[model samples]
Target: MPPFVLRSPEVLLSVPTPADIDRIAVVCTDPAIAEWTTVPSPYTRADAETFVTGMVVDGWARETMFTWAVRAPGRPDGTVLGMMAIGLIPGGPGDAHAGEIGFWTAPDARGRGLTTAAGRLAADWALDPSGLALERLQWRGFEGNWASRRVAWKLGFRYEGLLRRHGVRNGTVCDDWIASLLPEDPREASEPWPQEAPTS
Candidate 1:
């Protein structure tokens, strides 16, 4: 399958290209990202190049995973604000309709809803009956990744519970929070989340 594109009023999502390697490398260098995500510690330019040129490319070619580079509408061909991916979940006995979703936002791009917007777009496309036909989208993250948990909740993913020692980060086992979104779930935020009042 050819590269897919998803766009919203504020953001654009597309397959990562060679030109995005520099931005990817820089973004992955942020300690927060490396700490919470699977990104390599001391992330290097070579890692970014391989991800864009190898993983991203081969994933689409094999139909096993789909990734998108997120950017602002004004800089469609410029720097990426973040990245999102949907991957097939291996299952037994005729079960091939499940997928997992993951994402990370550049440090400079956080708090602007860029990652949330990008995630919404990806989920919409993946769950469409005429698109991937995926029946469920699983979301899992380290237990303390509140930001990621908030995004999943905002996307209408129902909280399932927690898994003990089910996640690994930087080679150490850790607990994980799990959630899922079904085709019938609302695409908009449905639950009330507490937030600090804006100060004038």
Candidate 2:
């Protein structure tokens, strides 16, 4: 599938490019991103270059995963507020149209709905008959990642319970929370979000 853009009132999702390498590198260094995501622990400009100049472009070229660099309107071209991707979950005919969603937000961009807004646009396109037409889009985050879980919840992904030892973080296996969204599902929180445990 060709690279495309998804728009929202507060955010726009477009493919990240070589020009955004610096910003991408900076964003990936956020401790929280590495804690919950697969990004290299010590993210570097070189990694960013390979992502934007290599992986990201190749994902689109091969029609396997669609990743978008999220930014607000009028923001500088290099201002990447977040990253979102929906990758085809390889499976047999019964699961032919399944995909998985992943994302991370810049520290400064937290507490805003931009990530949520941007994600909705991505999911909408993935499930639309005229779009990817995927029957299901799953969300997985290592347990304790309430931030990512909230976004998934707000997007109406039905919580499907945890997958013990399913997620790997910085090399260690960890439990992962899983959820799924179907094309016909209402795009709203399906249940009350669990309150976060207070930090000492």
Highest-scoring model, TM-score? 2
Give the Cα error of residue 78 in candidate 1, in Å. 2.3
The count of backbone overlaps in candidate 1 is 0
lDDT (0 to 1) per candidate: 0.88, 0.89
The local distance difference test score of model 1 is: 0.88
Instruction: Show where candidate 2 strays beyond 4 Å.
Output: 74-78, 92-95
Error of 1 at 1 (Å): 0.9
* TM-score computed on alpha carbons, candidate 2: 0.95
> Per-residue error at 10 for model 2, in Å?
1.5
In order, what is each prediction's RMSD in angstroms? 3.5, 1.6
Per residue, candidate 2 scores C-alpha lDDT tens digits across 1-200 of 78877886788888897889998898899989989899998999999999998899899999888999989965436489999898998892356599989999999998989889988999999899999899999999999888899999999999999899998989999999999999999999978888787876
How accurate locally is residue 70 in candidate 2, as Cα lDDT from 0 to 100?
A: 89
Report the lDDT tens digits of candidate 1 across residue range 1-200: 89867888979998889999998999999988988999888899999999999999999999989998989875557688899999989891238799999999998889998888888988988889988888999899997788998999888888888899999988999999898898899976676764534555
Q: Looking at candidate 2, what is the lDDT of residue 191?
A: 87
